[model samples]
Target: MQRVRLVDVARDAGVHPATASRALNPAVVGEVSQATVQRVRRSADKLGYVPNTLARGLRTSRSYVAALVIPDITNALFPPIVRGAEQVLTEAGFTLVLTDTNSATEVERSQIASLRAHGVDGFIVATASWHDPLLDELATEGFPTVLVNRRCATSALPFVGGDDQQGVRLCVEHLVGQGHRDIVHLAGPSNTSTGRERADAFRAAMRDHRLSVRQTVIECSAYTEQAGAAGAARLMARRRPFTAVVAANDLVALGAMDALGSAGVTCPRDYSITGFNDLAFMDKLTPALTTVRVPFTEMGAHAARRLLEWIADQPPTATQSMLPVELVVRGTTGAPPVD
Candidate 1:
């Protein structure tokens, strides 16, 4: 069977091959007229024509592929982010290559080097640490890279994510509004921006409400459930009389819940809890989790779009794109119980 080519489609559409190519290419779709674009698309659809991406890449000197590097693929929070970025890249006639580094810095650097060596056009990274030397190096080289959901403190890299400080403030305020004056915080690791920002925000919010920050705050080694449980246990061992717990993220909140249950405590009866990120299934928990919802999908999509702009030699107007957050009140929070 003879394979249909761009020339064949162009002939069927009564236009030159160049015009048809321009019409079909998403990167340059605006260069062609709408009527011509429609005609070429119809002809190509009728002939079941598929674009030769390899040939197009050779002509444009672009692989039209982007790499999205994440820290932990096993986490439930990343799937929505990946899907959102994938959708935007696909529509732009590009492919996404996903890599997970298990939160290892050296492995993440190696993955980026490998992807660059293989000629990937750009990158969207979500594994940046607070002081990432590798990311600084990439920025020094002026690479087309964007940070998503995480960012480096030293690099001038464009980032898209939720406002961690504002989100934590909302959580603290919510718990305080319920008369939880003595609230404990299970903070994530201090090495990452999300952890540090949220932890600092928790401290500031508590101080603003005239609460003791040092006595109620406990730092976790990582953002895992085990770390959360350990933090909670440590807080309890300190003999601090607190009526509420504010976890840095949903997974941490779940861990805190487990720790409290094992100690014969019940949520909203003995204590109330709040979580961040509002991950899936929070509403269906034994006692629905009250959390702050970050726009994960929007963050992913915006990061992809920003990378594309950079790749096209059109830098974004801002270096930081902070998406808004919302507080979701549910069954896990209530007024402090009578002592």
Candidate 2:
């Protein structure tokens, strides 16, 4: 079978080869007239002509590929984010590559270096820590990078994430409105921005409601069910008198519930609880989870677009994009159990 060439496509589209070339390449397609670009694309499609990305990369010094770095691939919370970013990148004539680093800094560094060596154009990172040295290094090297769902404290890189502080405050406010005063917070690791911001927000919200700011924050080692279970168990060991638990995320919330149940405690009967990030099937749980809904898909889409803009030399003046969140009321939350 004869491979369809650019000249044939140009001829079929009734345009010069140069015009067809510009039309087919997304990076330079904007230079061509819209009508001509459409015509050329239609002709290429009809002729089954595939763009030679390798040859084009050699000429333009760009692979037209981007990398998305995530902390864990197994987490249900990341699928929507990946879907959103993939759609945007695919429409823009770019390939999206996904890599998970198991939330390890050394693994993240190694994976990033490998991706860069492979000639990926830029990165959309969701694995940044609060004060990541790798992020600072990437900034110093002038890499085209955008952060999602997390941000580095010292790096100047642009970030796209949900309003974590607002989410936590909303959770606290909702629980307080339900007549729960002595609430404890199950927090993620302070090394990450999401953890720090949400923990701080919980404290501030409690203070705003005139609740005591005592030793109410129990820090989890990670944002996993195991960590959450251990944290909850540790909290229970202290025999703290609390009526509600504000978990860092849905997984943590579920773990806390499991731990409580093991000790013959049940949600909303013995204690009310709320979680952040209304992950899939939260409503399907035995006792439906009440949580804060962050726009994960929107965050991913905006982060991809922002990374593209930076790659196009249109750096955003704003350092951060904080999407809004909503509080979802469900069966897990209620007025504090009658004493």
Best by TM-score: 1
User: What ranges in model 2 sit over 4 Å off?
Assistant: none
Q: Summarize candidate 2's per-residue lDDT along 1-339 as a digit string, tens digits.
A: 988999999999999999999998876788999999999999999999998888888887888899999999988899999999998888788899999999888999999999999999999999998989999988878889999999988898999999999999998999889999999999999999999999999999999999997999999999989988998999999998999999999989988999999999988799999988999899999789999998999889999999889888887654899999999999999999887
TM-score of every model versus the real structure: 0.98, 0.97
Please identify model 1 stretches exceeding 4 Å from their true place.
none
Tell me the tens digit of each residue's lDDT in model 1 across 162-210.
9999999999899999888988889888889998899899999999999
Q: Which has the greatest lDDT?
A: 2
TM-score of 2: 0.97
Clashes of 2: 0
The TM-score between candidate 1 and the true structure equals 0.98
lDDT of each: 0.91, 0.92
